[model samples]
Target: MSLRKIKRPQGDFWFDFEAFAEDEDGFWLRGPVGTPWRAPHATGSSEVPVVVLLAPGRPWAAWWVGDPADRRLEIDVCRPPERDGNGWQYVDLELDPVLHETEGRVEIEDWDEYDESVRNGWMTADDAKLARVVAEGCAQLLHQRSEPWLDRGWKMLPDS
Candidate 1:
């Protein structure tokens, strides 16, 4: 499957992944090392395998890095994914919750981008509000390690 991240007032990014698995809540996408990805300013391939969960109505997409010694989870706050051609697309809300499992750290990244989007009216007020709520919730889930997607992603990791 293909995943497109649409960032308002910015260039969109796309990734090609395989459909690894699916359940009631969402489907898992697996991208192997060297999977090519393209962004606005740059293009590169993944250095490690990745597992991503894209739920239909969830406000965030969870990404699991497959580096065993440096495994981490990253969640992007977005406007829920929707079908776009043969893949899916979602508007990125800017805020992201990143969990560094090895360090037991959770940080909300890209606050400046979020703020700029809101101040410049790049995103709607309601969307910004929803982004904030989802970011906070995702951070808390990362801290508690309570989200099933977290574990599910780990299980799907390469060589897990």
Candidate 2:
């Protein structure tokens, strides 16, 4: 009889979120998506992310060009049920208008309560919402430009 071959899985090793959580201070650094945000340090930092103001329990994520080397950010988010409401859904935002007047960075301040049905669909739940704000913060803080990264990969993946 001929010998049979076994198939192995591909790609990187499994990521341990629990371990990651134990190491970090907050669950999220850049802040959560959909919820209103305020920039406590927007005018400062020159061209780097200083800080983001997020309601307690929400996640925070941001992006910036780090030391010209391998760089990545670990992110975490609160589930929908855990949140207070649906103010962060994809159909209730106006990103273009928000970033239009800014030089390159987009600073979010005065996060008044918002209804999910009104906000535009610029971002989603899966895309580490904090990262989007961080990216915009970097663009504005440094170059006064902003480009949202919503629905980017969704077009490629099959719908659930």
Top-scoring candidate (lDDT): 1
Worst 10 residues of 2 by lDDT: 1-10
Question: All models: lDDT?
Answer: 0.89, 0.24
lDDT of 1 by residue, 16-98 (tens): 88887889759888998988899999999988899888988888898989777778898999999987788889999999999
Candidates' RMSD to native:
1.7, 18.6
True-vs-predicted CA distance for residue 80, candidate 1, Å? 0.8
Please write out the lDDT profile of model 2 over residues 1-160, one tens digit for every residue: 0101111111111111111111222221221122222232222122222111123333332222221232222111212112223222111121211222213323443232112312433234443354345435533532432222212211222212
Quote model 1's TM-score: 0.93
* Clash number for each model: 0, 28
TM-score of each candidate?
Answer: 0.93, 0.18
lDDT of 1: 0.89
